[model samples]
Target: MVRWNILPATCILNSCIINIYDEGDCIPPHIDHHNFVRPFCKVSFMSKSNILFGKQIDIVDLGEFRGVVEIPLPVGSVFILKGNMADVAKQCISGVRHRRVSVTFYKMDDSKAPYRFQPDPELEELLPYQL
Candidate 1:
């Protein structure tokens, strides 16, 4: 068995696309909270894709939020986003088909660590918190 160590202030974002399709697929624009993310956010592309980033300005071009990166993530290439790397990743998504999929990582606080940690309190405490 493999052992993975996770600690507070520790966050990890891992992405995997087990299935894929032709080109022209894209993940639409989105913003993931930085404070809640792991130290690393990994986005692994299954096939060739054009991941664009920026704010919608007029109709022709997106505002100069940041430069765009043409990420042609290979089959086994792992892309890690740190610091402001993710900020530039928020732009209108196009070019690829919807068959492409990637994952964003988030670090759940210990208070919500789930069954992996100590067995949470009995039903008394758990039931009330769910609501």
Candidate 2:
């Protein structure tokens, strides 16, 4: 949670939408920080494929050691989480090798996603390549 003074804060997310495909449409391994704002995120899963959610997330409601989070989500199964949790989920997602589309709904830090008032050449370069 460190912030710089001189360097203008970067617009991590902005009003951008990242949708990639892998034949089986597999996304890369990373966090959802560059999407929305706030310290939380949400995603809606829709597919008949064998969907799996990695990392051991202990749901207070469910008292069981769930392996990977495998969901047979029909068409609109919404999964929500806090910002930090979303980041962790992204890490788990990175290792997934399958065909699925993760429709994410979350926020970013610093500013509201694209908090950058203007343009940042450095972050701009890191933008295209980051996704």
Candidate 3:
């Protein structure tokens, strides 16, 4: 990931969430919570879809919406979310015609960590592999 320049060397992803989208499934436009650190990534799999971006998204109908822009997310692709795109703009995925999966990776702010949170030692000092 470092070689691809998707993340800086100083950044360490410590949290993850998986989303499975079924047919006609959609996500409303919204920004991520402040608890997550910047420069997170969403990896797409199984199918392709357009990720909508806009300051104001209009709900046209059930599982349908209109946005200022639509970015295609291809299968096995990594869509990095950071800076203005991650903080200022609201993003959403429209209803998919088929099953799709996405895994998002984030770094939880240390100050926002839960009391029961314990750092995983194994994830520390991870270095990129040499192909």
Candidate 4:
């Protein structure tokens, strides 16, 4: 990610979570925890879908919801979240028609790391290209 300048040198992504979504599977709307650093990102794969963003996402029914805005998430694309988008607005993916996978990367606050968490030495001091 650093080589592509997707993330700056100051932001080291040390943690990741993989999400697998099956047909009819939906993700509830919520903001990322403060324990995780900002400027996080989710890379999509396998399928295309829409991500909803709003201050309040209302559940209309099982696998249904109402959001203020929607954004298309194409396969092999990266969605970066920072500032208010990471801390204020909530995001969710509605029930998908096909299997989908996403890998989310973020920097975890040192003080909030899990009890057994150990920082990976390889991810330290990641520097983006000078160009």
Query: lDDT of each model, Cα atoms only?
Result: 0.43, 0.41, 0.89, 0.88
| TM-score per candidate, chains pooled | 0.47, 0.40, 0.90, 0.87
Task: At residue 71, give the lDDT of candidate 1.
Answer: 52
Sorted by lDDT (best first), the order is 3, 4, 1, 2
Task: Residues 1-131, candidate 1: write the lDDT tens digits.
Answer: 00133223344322222334445533445655544544444354554444454443122333212225445554445455545555534543454543555554455445545465554366325421222
Superior by TM-score: candidate 1 or candidate 2 = 1
Candidates in order: C-alpha RMSD to true structure: 9.4, 11.7, 1.8, 2.9
Q: Model 3: per-residue lDDT, tens digit, 25-129? A: 998999998799988999999999999988898899998989998999999999999998899889999899889999989988899999998777876767657
How good is model 1 by TM-score?
Answer: 0.47
Tell how far residue 93 is off in model 1, in angstroms.
Answer: 4.0
State the TM-score for model 3: 0.90
Per-residue lDDT of candidate 4, residues 1-131 (tens digit): 76787987667787888999999999899888889887889999999999998999999889877899999999999998998888999999999999999999998888997899775677565654576
Candidate 4, position 102, lDDT: 94
* lDDT for model 4: 0.88
Candidate 2 vs. true structure, TM-score = 0.40
As a TM-score, model 4 comes out at 0.87
- The reply for model 4, stretches above 4 Å from the true place, is 120-131
